[model samples]
Target chain A: MATSIRFDPIRLPPETEVLRGEVRAFLAEEIAAGGFDPRGGYAAERFDRSFSRKVGAKGWIGMTWPRQYGGHERSFLERYVVTEEMLLAGAPTRGHFVADRQSGPILLRHAPEDIKQDILPRITAGECTFCIGMSEPDSGSDLFAAKTRAEPVDDGWRINGRKVWTSSAHYADYMIGLFRTSAPADDNRRHGLTQFLVDLKAPGITIRPIQFPTGKHDFNEVVFDDLILPADHVLGEVDMAWKQATSELAYERSGPERFLETIEVLIELVRVLGAAPDSRGSEGIGRLVAQLHTLRRMSISVAGMLAAGEEPMLQAAMVKDLGTNWEQALPGLARDLAAFADSSPTNRATFDSVIQNATAVAPKLTIQGGTTEVLRGIIARGLGLR
Target chain B: MAEADTIVVDVATRIFQDLGDPQTVNNAGDDSWRAPLWQALTDSGLTLAWVPETAGGSGGARADGFAVLGLAGAHAVTLPLAETLLGGWLLAESGLEAPQGPIAVAPTRHQDRLTLAQDGTLAGTACQVPFARDCDSLALAAEGADGPVVALVAGHDCAIRPGLNLAGEAKDDVIFDGARPRLIAPAGADRDALMLMGAAARAMQMAGALQTLLDLSVRYAGERKAFGRPIAKFQVIQHDLARLAGETAAAVAAANSAGAAIEASERVDAGLLLDVAAAKIRVGEAAGTGAAIAHQVHGAIGYTKEHILHRFTHRLWSWRDDFGPESVWATRLGESVAAAGADELWPTITAA
Candidate 1:
């Protein structure tokens, strides 16, 4: 059979357009009120609790979850608009973004009802923060090679392992981590890992900053030294995280965050170039715009598929692979275009700062979430090559 | 509406499969298959798909006609289906009745220009006009003293210089030296609108061709063996195919999005311009990247004329240059975005 990859034309519904206007207006107001700098290059890493709370109060956090669990019960496309607006405006979403995006959804799907009632509400209120603990010092892309262990104890579990490159772990209130619950069954290498909800406040937990080369500390080494977790903290079926993890990937890998990471550079490039640019500047900007628009359309189509409850894993992977590469390349493209541009001193300074930060962070865009290599493998599998 | 669209696409696909099969057409020495395929397409009312029922043509939705163009690309159809559909639409839009049989549009290239004089004479040359040699009539949007005018001129009235694109399809240069048009009327559209439509059509076709390339590459990989196993098992070949799939997916997504955007709106505004321009630029890039990867994966066999790979790949190369190459559209789009200012960029994109 031929490998069929479908991304049907899915325009955001009319209601989402209404939500988009509200989001754009809200973002404008926030910028006006000095909530966060729209020029900030890495807004996702800039933690701002008050801003997240303001966004939460607007009913955007956990917007797609069930209403009973502090969600607004909105569609994913609505959440998509809100998410994209925040990213494009460079709003500080670090405080509640993880919880709003993936943690809450996982809890809704697999967490106990009482746990969901307790934590989901706080997450929705943007009063809580969450971090993902998947990659280890040893196991990066080969997830099944993780050495993290969680031994069953008296009415609880004792976890011991170190998760490197854990974003927001330094300030996060909780971490949804994967720990080896059992050894691999003879045939299945991905069998042992099990997911658990680890409270960061619990004893025997340590978080150390992993500073970037630019001296900015956004990631952390989350060391769980015999960290105790309640029996109820186990999420989903035991020894079945392989199945659970794949489902969340469609959500994790395909968001606007993947593509718009370095949008400030493009925006600044346009600012630097000014109106009526020369052919060189204009053509460069035009190709970038065309590429950006294409990626957005593909990403939105994936969102619509997700909204319709279709698991577009392959399409989502394709989006991230293309989106991250595009984003990573944007700074370089901007620098090239800006060389020919005549900008005012203030605009030139702003452009320099923006492009510098973007170039610094460019290496991680393809490496984070899932590496380009890993994503390509997934796509190959989808193509019936494996 | 969706069901009807599916039926229409299914019918078109089936007809292409029966009459325009790539392998069959590639092996045939003569142009025998062209007549049957064009006849089947005409009998199905697909040639004038974009024209309204009141305009003496098929009244299919613009979206469906665009979809058929994509199928045409997949089959490597040698007929003037896209051009005829575009021609009929141009005539219909200007309240002019479309003539039957194959029709071709002029000024296929962005740099080319045609003009209509005050004395009702058509002047100037349109280079690389697709299927102009065989067109019964030519529909053109020429720059007139009063804005633009749509004109229908018989093919025999114009001086023709035979040319061919990479796919060996007929793309001729037509010179209208004071030739009087059979019909002329005021047009609400301009050259840009016509180019956008043409770019959009080519983008869809390139996207379809990319899909076929991917399919062919995958099948070949599974069957072609090296190093004691099928090359499909090789990590490098798999990665190549994966990248090809990514390129194909991007092209298909962008093309479908553009087609849908054009269908959703009545006018070609800034939003629609972005959609069409992006589709053309991105899909054109994909056609290049995707064709290379497909060839690399297929090895030497794909390079031969006996194989069907060139049918799609060659067409992709030719189509990329048809409606203002990527550089032209990119510059136009970039200038517009810059003119709108940085703050307005996000709003403009979101609005689209």
Candidate 2:
């Protein structure tokens, strides 16, 4: 059994807090150049294609990736520097996140040669966007039961079934879906499934945007009604979709983004409170600040683990499970802090909108990667209990 | 501060775990409530871990002794371990070095000047004293012209009027009208350190108690079956448990870091107070959650005194409300963290 993870804190070469300033300058220029509003912060998908391309050109995207993949070959800490800057700036980076962080690396390690050659440069140049198609109606936390079948055809495969919660499908280029290849067996039903890169514009692929509890089209239910795919589009080895999917999840679950999802509002709340604090506001915000710092450290530690070539599934799970709360709690905390005194309708309306749109989604945070119970069970098993 | 502290924590944790299952404690039918565990601690020299090494004590850091007290909390073993270690240390630091056996201190806060004579007299009453009945000696924090002075006296050296809390832990109204006593530390010897040290110790205890209830609730969720399956298999139960574990970890981290920081710091000032306050608030919130969730997980079984879960959960609820509840710290911490030139009310809220 693997032992409990004891992380020694990573000490950075103590740099000036002015690193924040440098990032702000770059983002301010980008925002002005592209006319992005602060209201949406990073959530609006106001993604400037040219701006992202420039950022990538500046050796920011794939900053920590290997030089062989047209990356800068910087350390994970260095990439952290870039990420923190972008987030602090509230720059829209999600469009390039999956491709740069997960799919690009997945291509490097396991994707076939032709597939790697086709996707790596596009991702590095921030020209391509990839959305995950792992969750489905009947099979979300339990993706093994997903009925999305990919029957072998003449040249490639004929896929039929539905995928739910594809976030960027309305605007995305392609989708990476986990498809079942063969009938279930006693040994392992999970083994027959494989990941295939499907073109969003392909025939017989129906993309219906699913309006969520909040009136947002951030998700869609995409159906594959006999959509055909070339044999070359399969990601990694056939019948090894679980491994690839898990790896993608590890990337999504381990990033600084997990904790920073609603941090914009948090900082805004702090800014609104101003430098001087009322007695109640000071203590409430201090606790939140301390909690945020701890989560950031844990998330950074998870990143460090990933950097060292460790899966750290449980550690990552811990970070996501806890990080989700901070995201969900942001609006509520903002409201609570402002409740004691005078608060403008503008901030209240904004906070209400966020709460309406995000809080219900917060519970899904743990469910997205794996359920909290599942993580705890895994942790307990790691601790050697039955 | 030393590597051995980790070893001590490991040892203390193991001993507490071996003894913690309150189920066994309840089933054993031992009502006298003597702790073989406390004796084990005495044997391990944990009792003297915080006592001054100069005053015939094996003094280490305050966290050294407090960590052990935290172990006692985790095990749900109630034997006044913190009270005595803190009390004995107060006594030792008072230049008394007089507590030979298990001695507990009730540090009282009195407004009037304590009339101390060469014959060791302690006069006047101290409000908001904890564990007064359980303590052997009273560590009175007498108000001096400069600051609060700490002194120790026999429990019965003053009147022992009974007082109590919701938890079964005994308390008494401690009165000393010119009753004889011995001086511990001189006035103005960094009572702030003692206060921060206390916060650190209490935070650890509350953190441990939170974990204890977290474990109890999780175990209940796993073993107690409903609808022909373990209730833990449900998504809602899973979510609850996940939230519980997350909060427990936060509390542990806060308390753990605060204890470490208190140990590392040379002085306990506003920053230390803020850290301790933060730890205390988190631990208090964590304890409440643990208590609430343990009951929810246990369903009807938790409400009965017969169940061992109540033993731990009840203690958590009790301790959480004491020592200035979470909101109290919230206001204080809020003011402490406020940028200068802030509201006058902020400072007023933190006047103590």
Candidate 3:
């Protein structure tokens, strides 16, 4: 029999509330200083190095890591507060988001001492940026099928491959590239793949922008001819990147970012609807808010489980699957709810712009991180269906 | 959960396991198991779990009562356990003593109203009152001259038109032409507060039912054979079951969070309203999606009345309509969110 899934009703502690207030005050001050626009989509995708340094100065970046590594040694929940507040305010967080969320933690756990000593401090100081190089031309969801080769040399590895759809690579200082070290075994296709931390400024490396149809320049294709990395750059064991790749996913999949991506549109929809909306409008808004709240609760519960040292991989997948789908649908739902709103020029323009941007971004939410099909497969394994 | 909450849930689970097993009750022809189940619930004080000891009933934490309700839902019992607990809670909130046998609360529907007249008689009709005909007494909320009042009235005094929900449980239309309350007191909670509380309870029940449906569907998929292999081996079935599991997890998380919020709150304020409303809406949606996926996984066997799946699914469908449907709660919640405007939406959500 399949056992029940437990969510434990985890509530944020009083300290988290205190931290949230601080974050809000900081964001408010930044907004007053014209650092970013809360209502505009421009800030969400933009990387502001100075803003990231200010956030790092506040000890928000790598807040959950050790103090010796320039971290504040705070709780994960506290870090959660800072992250969510930034996302909600549409702050320019793209500069340090990937490093703070996944790369920093991965290095903290799996990297060697010298690598950690060299890179961890820069990440915590928000002076560096990281991008994931997991997907290739034919290896998007099936990551093990990556054709990138890393041949061993004297005291280093020569990597030669192409990584497509690599976010932030154009401005990133480093890329955590997965490479094929050997041929896959007959029974284990996931073997022979290795994770290497590569400096993007290295020789024989090129980054070409892959512009979206929305005219956004966020993604890039990174080409490597003979990129060399020292032996210490490899994360965890060689040919065992698959196992290491999954450990950070629970953290990656179940954060406020997954659901809050297009929340501005929903907020804009409510503003357009005014106070006394019709039953249809009210019902639509209500269902969307309810769904958002539920996703947040589930995500927080997963965070709590992580804090308690439980690997709730299945629950995290569920959160990402449901949260991404909900966020992706927010634009359409908001469009429908705002159908009968007053046709004032200001209102129409604001709603239309917000919805248009959100709609353009919606398609990538489900496809990024882990695809919906892959997540469901993970959940099926959790359910013992496979 | 605290230790006391765990003990309370354990007691309720033990009682349900002993006397309220779904398969056992479904296989039986008559209503023989109902009395023993009620008696066991009463004996353990589970029926009056929320009433205060000062109000002549066993007192427990609100979280404990909610946890027990989840257990009751998992068992898919047809008894009036949830109704009685809500009734006792109503009476306790008004500083009135709860009566002995099974009790039902009136105004289960959000818009249903009862009035306390100058002559101390209760009037107005409460439609779709759960277990109205089966209960010994009714704990009702009525609009009084001062404000909303809670009244305890014998079930025999009022006229009840028999009705049954999709689950085949009592859902009668109760009319109070001039029924005199045995005891009436000033209620601390208003109509909206009571509705929110009741909605939260139903959300928990739906969550529990969704869990059981997920488990049954998974088990069936693992056992049922197709194309010389287990049906679960098929990628399509695995995906469907995975979706069902996701829906079930969402419902569980939402309901549990709402219950925890209610327990932590001093009163039914806007924060609690947000939690309860969200829980009700999300869990109701989950119930609809989860039941369909579960039945699909079970195939024809799950469609039959003889199967235990419908017992839970039927109640899941019926309970979604109680207190307030998804649309009703959604409208209220939506109006509030819109009124708060775009700038305050994140703050309001983060507060909860």
Native contacts retained, all candidates in order: 0.89, 0.27, 0.93
What DockQ does candidate 3 score?
Answer: 0.85
Q: Model 2 over residues A1-386: C-alpha lDDT tens digits?
A: 02223332332222423443465577778778764554563352445567667777777777666676678776766676667666655677766776776767766776677777677777778887777788888888777888899988999999999999877787777788889887666888777788888888899898998886656566788999989999988777887676664555666776777766556555545545656667667767767655665565556656666777777676677677777756767767776786664545775566565555456556555565566566766555433333
Stretches of candidate 1 exceeding 4 Å from the true structure? B1-4, B269-271
Which numbered prediction scores highest in lDDT against the true structure? 1
| Alpha carbon deviation, residue B240, candidate 3 (Å) | 1.0
- For residues B159-251, what per-residue lDDT tens digits would candidate 3 score against the true structure? 999999998999999999799999999887767777888999899888988888998899999999989999999999999999999999999
Point out where model 3 deviates above 4 Å.
Answer: A42-44, B1-4
Instruction: Give the C-alpha lDDT of model 2.
Output: 0.66
lDDT for B254 (candidate 3): 95
Docking class of 1: high
lDDT against the true structure, each candidate? 0.90, 0.66, 0.89
| TM-score, every prediction | 0.98, 0.79, 0.98
TM-score of candidate 2's chain B against its reference? 0.85
- Which residue pairs collide in model 2, if any? A282-B334, A283-B334, B94-B184, B94-B185, B120-B181, B123-B178
lDDT of 3 by residue, A1-386 (tens): 25599888998888899999999999999999998777768455788899889998899999999998889989989988898899888898988999999999889988999889898888887899999999999999998899999999999899998999999999999988899998998999999999889999989899999999988899999999988889999888999887885658999999999999777888888888887789899899899999999999999999999999899999999999999999898898888878888856897798899888889999999999999999999999999887
* Tens-place lDDT digits, model 1, residues B1-352: 1312888899999999999999999999789998989999999999988888887787998899999998888888888888998888888888999999999997788888889988989899999898899998999989998889989999999999999999898899999978899999898556777898899999988898898999999999999999999999998998899999999999999999889988888875555888999999999999999999999988899999999999999999999988789989998999899999988888888888
